[model samples]
Target: MMLTNAVLCLLIGYVGSHGRQEMFSVLVCIQTVVFVCCETVLYDAGLYRWQLFIITCVIAAYTFQRLHLSKKLPLRLSCFCMSLYLSKATIVLIEHFVFHPNKVPVYSYVTILFLVFMIIRIFVTEFDTNAHSFTGHLGLLCVSVIVNANPLIYVLSSYIFMTESAASDIAGLCSMVCGVLIIIAQSIHVPEDLRVRYTGVLGIFLGLVFIVFRPNLTPTLYSVFQWIEVFSVISFVIVMVTDSVTQFLQIMLCSAVLGLCPGFRAAIMLYPEDNIPVSGVLLFMLSSCIITCIILCFIKAQHLKHTFEKRFIKMSTMLAVVSMVAVISDISTRENHQMFLTLPSLKLILCANLVISICLKLLALRQIGELLPLTEPKDDKEVPYLPTIGNIATFISFVMICLMAPTSSFYHDVWCCGASLVLVCLQKDMRIFSSLREDNQTTATKITSLVILVTATLYRSDIWNYNSSWMFARGVTEIILVLFSIPNCYILWGLLYDNVLVLNEQIVIFTLPLNFPLILYSSSYTGWALAAAGIVSSIWMMFAKFALQPYHDDY
Candidate 1:
């Protein structure tokens, strides 16, 4: 609420009569921060002072207009800010792909800093201890500023001479800034509620700047999503326990990439033909994510008396992935008699890479288990625990994506983006199948969940999109066009499912006929399958959660 008041004050101050003075001040603050980050980190993202001035003026004008309204706007301001951000980011992304093909797209300084500020605000709202929350938030902001400033310093310093080390120095400096931030932030014991809230934003930006930046880092579904769980779930615990900025940075970077599977796929598809094998490995990693989820779910289910075969689940999943790879390879090789790629070799290579990955991960998990707990309970009796159902259903949705290998055809980019947002914002107690457990509903929870789900559903349905069509039959542009079908089943499901993410009387009635083969066959097999799996999984997990409650003696 303090943060809310501060934002209101800040908003009101900008809109009031002394507009230019205050408005210009924020621009100066942003530019100064940008200059510092560029000079220090050598991350020379395009930041024209004139452009900053223009954007500042535009936003200020909009704020002034909005301030004329008597009532306060919740999503309007935030969504306005985010919509502008998405526009800028999209422009940047397009520019990166077109003009600057090699370089990763960097975000605007305002967006980055705003996210940092947002993280702090979220912590204030979620965490109980005022001192820790305030200081923790400040420390995070400080680290972001310092780290960003270092990059600016390095970039400006390199303008003197075209020396390569200067650039490397900048990149290293930026990396170091991230490292320093993590170390400092972790020094304090951040509270539990705040950690969960902060991780979603942190994980994303970190993923943008840090994790995906690694030269040799391979994209795997398991690795990427697990990384998300770290920021979304584990980071919350770490923040609560150690409160280290260093660890938090790592968690944030991880989470950012988790929801970016479609982006990652696009990246892989663009890789050189020789590196096609890498795509398979990347995909296998994605499948292995299910394995990891299965492991987590199985453990939880066993403790809670849910039935899932340990050996069979493991073997079946592996075999299914392997069999699919084999099938794809056979079809690909046969089809490639006149094409560019040898699908069979790539498939074999991918499977091999995946198997090796699983073994290595098993080894890593063996040792890392001691360093982390599976889950951290918040406020002993307040925030209900996230059951195995939520995790499993989400995994199911994800697994379907991999199984069908949905391209822009069915599970379009919008769908991927939607699901990812819902996931990263998901609470420890909320299941992907249902909504917030009544034992732990907060105002923030409703707002965050509502925004993500609504956005995701719209995106998933391709309602806001202009070129949304389904391709069912092979050759000719055969498709289903249902753009903006309002008062939709998805909305109803969201409303009903939001309260309890599992199977119950309400879910069973809605989900029963919904999951039948007829409806499933209606949409693109690949897209709808994943969507249906997500829905069905939610129901299954919820029912199973209740059934297994008697068995969970340890938890």
Candidate 2:
């Protein structure tokens, strides 16, 4: 009865709120679990998490919009889409388990379903989008291409097997290079805007054909065809970075993965290092990173660095991904269980660079108050970010990174120094700081907040590792933290609602109802104590803002 009720409630919510993908996804997942749990039918691997996710979502579709299943045949568009995703899934599972290089993948078939819907919607939907949202969607399509390119990537990267083996002797390395170039050519356009992501399904389709034939790939150069498909995905992403809102978020998410993620398990395999020659791929990646940084430096020179910063972060982040994966590989080269070995030095260098660069960015941002002309007027939303208490909390995370891992190459250390200097001298105007009283006062307030927050972080972290197992055991501390954390999220949502209209608009335009769940779920740091802290922090901030309301007149 309980299971039935949950499914029914979930069903209504999912259909009524079809716009919210995350919630809908969650509801479907839950309903699937409940149905499977309560069923008299025996549990099998077939009805497991991944399969259940899809089966449940389909059931929900049947319950609400019966046409979804009825209109589509057994080998329907949705099924085909699901098949493509499962192909990628098979590749992922194979790669993940074989190499033991990174993370354990718990993939759901629903991801494929999501991709299928995306393809249909991209061309068919009359959805309204800001320029950013539109571009972001294209960027995501490019990402999907990368995700789907697992087999080709595996083949191209598999030089050890290809070069040493008699089977690959027929294809030859030069042939591989040519094939890749052709694919790149087909996927791209001279003018970035000329690319089309609507043909994503087509690209995937062709790539499958190419993958199947690329081994012999003789008469029509099938390998070459696959390469073009891959290129199209890449080109679409490039276009997205140049002009999408969702693209920016995608960039940020990737950065977060690079900056905070400790292992390769979760990292997207762009060009798998294993199959490709180490020297070539590394050089190619390095060259791209340098070119990207230089382009961003030019934008900084012009003082038009807002959007450019996001790009810089994304490029650096992807390269850093390769570096981080290398770091993980070094640890577990002998046994798959090598994630145990922690390198403090390399982590220190990474942590230091991230910390210093963030500081430089923050320092430069502080000068905004001094330089701004009150007469020029400013949108509250556009007010340059002055680091907040949350930022300070995140900084504690960097400190944790340094403490947890040990490694510091001279090259990596140099990155820290270079990024710091770049932050300071990145812009001629950024180098300028004023001796104004208000500036000093503002600096003091921020510093004070930072010190307090860092102290809190230090205190929490001190006991965390010591009682780490106990902490994971779940108890009063954890529950309190969870409860307290929700209010902070509420506060966060309030702030986002008031000040981040542009971001919200972009999410709304492209992401559907998922935007709301995203806002709701952004309070990821919520835990027993953390939740309490958020509630207290938000209430205090509100009170403080109320008190300071009258002072806005003076400013």
Candidate 3:
């Protein structure tokens, strides 16, 4: 039990480390689960454990210490602590009156009920953020239920029907294949007016094919649950088609009650023998889910109000996809064999990717600032030495290639070295390449060449070898390398020509092929879900690129 508590605490800390509003809400939900499990364990044992109490106090103290250092502690923490003490006192009083052997208390059941109400009041006052009106909260909860229903159906079906058959796997595969085709169709070049119609028709045809072949794809739940799921799906489709908030909320509310079913069923199954009443357990789980959903809605609202930069959004999307892949890979390999790369290696790769991306963005922004017509004139003696930055970047690339050579195939190393030499020669203004340099290639062309070169290296490295568990990690590492090179190329292009190359459709088009390797490697439902998300994102990007092309052309 101590080990379990410690692990849960660590997970809470890790997931909440980002400190984003969305993550904080997830942290609250996780902490609530941990608290419930602890209470359940204590109830079964019929004794309060001092060690657990001490652990809680220690964690609270550490949290407070950090809050003090940050000087951003909320007043709610103090209120929460006061409410905890009040609830404890109320519980003790109720126990004294109701559980005593000798006392003849008047209306003992009514007294207990009143005490419970008081406890609820204290909690609601202390914890409620009141960021949204009651109706707004209710509407967001309904939306969350609608969005989560599709995935929840699969979860319940897997447990209740135990339907881990080949058909289900085939359905997942079909969905992935269709998703990929949609992405490809969207990426194809065609007349602007016809392109939209072409992609739409292709998407509809593929979706129909998927539905026809996978007729039993949807899970057959009990009558009530099935109707609720169907209603939620229909309401969701309507919301998408019409983009009407009033209709969304009205229709979704009817199906929102279904969200409570999973938690209620789970609690009943888990605590059938417990002393707690079924209703109380159901209420606890429902409250936790509602709180989580509300937080997610708040995060979404905040995001919509304050839009992020396009590059940041793109980087975040890529990071999220990569993180999902890592998690899926970890789960799939857990029982099979040891992973090829250590946790530290994966962390290093992620950190390297993040740092390189940020650096590239900063360099591009700086270049833009310098190029602005309104910029102050610089002193001739103080002119920035751009060549030094290029040479330093080339050296770093050479070092990276050497570091990866131990794991890379001969061809991969040879290609990387050749690319490094080309970069070095470009930095040195080699006479042999003077004519090619004189042409002043566009940033898109430069980035495309680099992406293809790196991708070719990855292919030659046999990084997709799936014969062993460790091989999977190697493949992921190589993929990360390919992604890492994209930003590096952008930075390099900026340094070489003293001009920033705004990333465009070419980057997405070239990188889209990497998704196939991911699809090929994925062997689980979660992995397929991530792959589908990647494809959807690619399709969105394709449309967005086309939508914004005229603006770029005019500029």
Candidate 4:
């Protein structure tokens, strides 16, 4: 009954969501139905977790029939389904044997919700319709599943020593056999042509350790073994899925797996009965040490200092950033403002990281700009300055909105200026703009405008502290402005990408008026009337000047 309700709620929520693909929606519904029905039938029949495991394998085969994934469907299903079911079984086994709470927490529903969200995020952000890329995303999804499933595996195995002697022996022997079979299957699936042949052998070795350590499983030992199995499964899947070999995907895979270990360890520590004395810190350090060793070996073998070295450094730096953020969050929650203030080191580190990240990103963007092929200078009359006019109109509308908005919290209007700057910077014909440049005048205008904008950003918080009543008014005005500008921005953004020629650098001159208005307007009827006038005129000018123009490439 509990399972049925959870599954039903999940399905209903999935169906009602906006912008979902039909195939994805159907796949989710079918999977949920199968999961609920299988649990219901198997539980009523008094089946062991092992029987449900076999049932999971059957479901995996059925899923492949529905989805029709190419290349090593059995192996993919085995890794995916086994990890999923093992976690499920581990939860059941622990509840039955170790600890039982009176009430099942609402957290299962939360878990399902999270699972759905992750599926959507992965599909939206990463997956494309291309088959190879889809396979890579699928492989990533499987790795995530394995990583998330590890905590349950640890909890189930943590107290193996405390179980009834005969039960422990039976469970140990069964686990040993299961591990061996998994390892053997993983080994066989490896292609013989690859020079890097030891992945399967390494998996086999990890499985053997799990088998050997089953008799005296401590919390620490169990966690170690579980991580090994989890990483081994990920490695095997990466090997089988050819498309997951790119540096970016590999970084994501490794980070997701290694990054969550602290959280998993901390969760166990948080529970009273489930509290394990093992240190999350030590576990993290161990994982890092192992990763570092592996990376060193790979670097030595590949000898791509330009590629691997840079990526590894970036990843390691990001990992440190994550750790710092975690520490700062932990400290802030304790309400120790004095300690936080005293820590100049933390502040310095954060500032340095911020500056470094910004510089690196700008460098990357500049490199990309350099690589873009130069296009032939088409006739200026081909595509009119329709986009530029639209942008100018929107900029005027935003300025009006800023003036009408409350004096407090008005710095958010700088976002409009930033948006305008982005449009200017992205112009492909950077050299063409210099022809329109009027000696030192444009440069002076740009510098003056930039300094003023930066000053506003630096002191906006303090400025808001002087008055609190404007807060609600500020939100209302901003929303109105956003609604007004969104259509205009969309049109202008499309125009920029359409390879049109226009005065790019002159957009920077508009920054002056964008920043100058904060000094002039009161949040009164007169201010609002002027704002309304600006909005109407700009939108009217946009449509009147550009709407009928055949500026679009297709037209």
Q: Which candidate achieves the best TM-score against the true structure?
A: 1
Cα lDDT of model 3 by residue, 366-464, tens digit: 444344221234476543333233334444444444445444544443445444442422232222232333334343334444554555545544455
Evaluated at residue 50, the lDDT of candidate 1 is 30
392-502, model 2: which lDDT tens digit per residue?
323443444434433343233223223222222122221133222232323323222323332333333323454565544433343333333333443344333342222
* Stretches of model 2 off by over 4 angstroms after superposition: 1-299, 303-307, 316-379, 382-397, 400-555
Give candidate 1 regions above 4 Å deviation.
1-130, 133-137, 140-179, 185-267, 270-315, 318-555
Q: Of the pair 2 and 4, which is ahead by lDDT?
A: 4
Give the whole-model CA lDDT for all candidates, comma-separated: 0.40, 0.38, 0.41, 0.40
TM-score of each: 0.26, 0.21, 0.21, 0.21
Best by lDDT: 3
Point out the higher-scoring one by lDDT: 2 or 3.
3
Worst 10 residues of 3 by lDDT: 299-308
How well does candidate 3 score on lDDT at residue 466? 76
RMSD to the native, candidate 4?
30.5
Who is ahead in lDDT, 1 or 3? 3
Measured on C-alpha atoms, candidate 4 has an lDDT of 0.40
What tens-digit string does per-residue lDDT give for candidate 1 at 254-361?
434442443244335434455455445454445444333433332233232212223324444564565476446444434334333334334333343343333323
* 178: Cα error in model 4, Å: 8.2
Off by over 4 Å in 3: 1-173, 176-191, 194-394, 407-555
- Per-residue accuracy of model 4 over 1-555 as CA lDDT, tens digit each: 556656765764665354344544454445545674576466546664546655664574455334434332233332343334434544454455555631324354334333333343343222343546544544444344334333333344455545434323434433443344333333343334232234334444444444443334446877574656455444544443443444544544654555354334433443233323334334334434334333432323233223533454444455455446545543544333344432322322333333333333333344353342212234865542312322333333334333333344444444433333322222222333323222322332233233334334334422244356565555344334323433333333333333232333223223223322422332433333323433443444355434434445755
